[model samples]
Structure formats: structure tokens, C-alpha cells
Target: MVKVATYFAMTFGAFLFWQSMDRVHVWIALHQDEKKERMEREQEIKRMQAELMAQAKESES
Candidate 1:
């Protein structure tokens, strides 16, 4: 009876560990996606600023 109880406890622990790892993986994936989007937006803003600068230079010429 003790052996059976030990096995059950181990199995339950493994299941809980797996669930926690899955949640961690999901959070990491979401964070990476958000970081990528932020980087893309920054690049776009830089591109727009460069275009405006070029236009200003042309108008001055």
C-alpha cells in the first residue's frame, strides 16, 4: 500500500511540473512576439524620420 501511494504521488508531481513548464513556455513565446513587434515599430519610425529629413534637404536646395 505504501508503494502504491508513493507511485501516485510521483505521478502527480510530474503532471504538475509539466503544466508549469508549459505555462512558462507560453509566456516566453508571447514576450518574444511583443519584443519583435516593438522593434519593427521603431524601425518604421526611423524610416519615416529619414524620409522627412530628405524632403527638407531637397526643399532647402
Candidate 2:
């Protein structure tokens, strides 16, 4: 009876640990995706600014 109870407790602990690790992995992946999106947005904004500057220079000429 004692062995059975010990096994049950260990199994429950392992299950909880696995669940928490899964959440951590998901959170890391989401942050990485967000970072990638932010970089792309910054690049796009820079490109637009360059285009606007070119237009202004052309208008000055």
C-alpha cells in the first residue's frame, strides 16, 4: 500500500512538471515570433521613410 501511494505521488508530480514545461516552451515561442514581427515592422518603416525623403528631394529639384 505504501509503494502504491508513493508511485501515485511521483506520477502526479511528473505530470505537473511536464505541464509547466509545456507552458514555458509556448511562451518562449510566442516571444520569438513577436520579436521577428517587430523587426520586420521596423524595416518596413525605415523603407517608407527613405521613400518619403526621396520624394521630397525630387520635389525640391
Candidate 3:
């Protein structure tokens, strides 16, 4: 009886650990996606600024 109880406890602990790891993996993936989007947005903003500067220079000339 003691052995069976120990086995059950270990199985439950493993299941909990697996679920926590899955959550961590998902969180990491989401964080990476957000970072990628932020970088893309920054690049777009920089591009627009450069284009505007070029247009202003053309008007001045």
C-alpha cells in the first residue's frame, strides 16, 4: 500500500511539472513574437523618417 501511494504521488508531481514547463514554453514563444513585432515597428518608423528628411531636402533645393 505504501509503495502504491508513493507511485501515485510521483505520477501526480510529474504531471504538474510537465504542465508548468508547457506554460513556460508558451510564454517564451509569445515574448519572442512581441519582440520581433517591436523591432519591425521601429524599423518602419526609421524608414519613414528617412523618407521625410529626403523629401524636405528636395523641397529646400
Candidate 4:
């Protein structure tokens, strides 16, 4: 009975450890995705700014 109890405890510990790692992995994935989206938004903003500048220059000339 003691050995069975020990085995159960070790298995539970391992399960908890694996679950924590899974959470970490999910968080990292979400962070990376957000970073990628932010970069894309920045690029769009830059493109829009350039277009506006060009329009202004044309109007001045």
C-alpha cells in the first residue's frame, strides 16, 4: 500500500509539472503572436505616413 501511494504521488507531481509547462508554452505562443501583429500594424502605419507625405509634396509642387 505504501508503494502504491508513493507511485500515485510521483505521478501527480509529474502531471502538475507537465501542466505548468503547457501553460508556459501557451503564454509564449500568445506573446509571439501579439508581437507579430504589432509589427504588422507598425509597418502599415509607416506606409500610410509615406503616402501622406507624397501627397503633400505633390500638392506643394
Candidate 5:
């Protein structure tokens, strides 16, 4: 009976560890995706600014 209880305890501990690791992986993935989106937005803003500058230069000419 004691051996069975020990095995059960070990299994439960391993299961919990695996679940925590899975959560950590998900969080990392979400963070990376957010970073990528932010970079893309910055690139878009830069492109728009360049276009506006070109338009202004043409008007001045």
C-alpha cells in the first residue's frame, strides 16, 4: 500500500511539472508574437512618414 501511494505521488508531481512548463512555453510564444507585431507597426509608421516627406518636398518644388 505504501509503494502504491509513493508511485501515485511521483506521477502527480511529474504531471504538475509538465503543466507548468507548458504554460511557460505558451507565455513565451505570446510574448514573441507581440514583439513581432510591434516591430511591424513601427515599420509601417516609418513608411508613412517617408511618404509624407516626399509629398511635402514635391509640393515645395
Candidate 6:
């Protein structure tokens, strides 16, 4: 009976550990995706600003 209980405890602990690890992986993935999106947005903003500057110089001439 004690052996059976020990086996169950071990299995339960493994299951819990696996679930936590899965959650950590998901969080990391989401954080990376957000970082990528932010960088893209920054690039776009820089591009637009450069375009505006070019147009202004052309109009002045």
C-alpha cells in the first residue's frame, strides 16, 4: 500500500512540474512576440519621419 501511494505521489509531482514548465514556455514565447512587434513599430515610425523630412527639404528648395 505504501509503495502504491509513493508511486502516485511521484506521478502527481511530475504532472505539476510539466504543467509549470509549459506555462513558462508560453510566457517566454509571448514576450518575444511582443518585443518583435514593438521593434517593427519603431522601424515604421523612423521610416515615416525620414520621409517627412525629405519632403520638407524638397518643398523648401
TM-score of each: 0.96, 0.89, 0.96, 0.91, 0.90, 0.93
TM-score of 1: 0.96
Superposed model 5: Cα runs more than 4 Å off: none
Residue pairs with backbone overlap in model 1? none
Q: What's model 2's lDDT at 8?
A: 100
- Is 2 or 3 the stronger prediction by TM-score? 3
Give the winner by TM-score: 3 or 5: 3
Quality of model 1 by C-alpha lDDT: 1.00
- In the range 1-61, model 2's lDDT, one tens digit per residue, is 9999999999999999999999999999999999999999999999999999999999999
Model 4, which residues run further than 4 Å from truth? none
How many backbone clashes does every candidate have? 0, 0, 0, 0, 0, 0
Worst 10 residues of 6 by lDDT: 1-10
lDDT of 3 by residue, 13-58 (tens): 9999999999999999999999999999999999999999999999
Q: After superposition on all CA atoms, what RMSD does each candidate show versus the true structure? A: 0.6, 1.0, 0.6, 0.9, 0.9, 0.7
Question: Better model by TM-score, 2 or 4?
Answer: 4
lDDT of 5 by residue, 1-61 (tens): 9999999999999999999999999999999999999999999999999999999999999
For residues 12-39, could you state the per-residue lDDT of candidate 4 as single tens digits? 9999999999999999999999999999
Query: How accurate locally, in lDDT, is each candidate?
Result: 1.00, 1.00, 1.00, 1.00, 1.00, 1.00
lDDT of 1 by residue, 1-61 (tens): 9999999999999999999999999999999999999999999999999999999999999
User: Model 6, range 1-61, lDDT digits (tens) per residue?
Assistant: 9999999999999999999999999999999999999999999999999999999999999
- With candidate 6 superimposed using the best TM-score fit, by how many Å does residue 42's alpha carbon deviate from the native? 0.4
Candidate 3 C-alpha error for residue 15, in Å: 0.4
Q: Which stretches of candidate 6 lie over 4 Å from their true place?
A: none
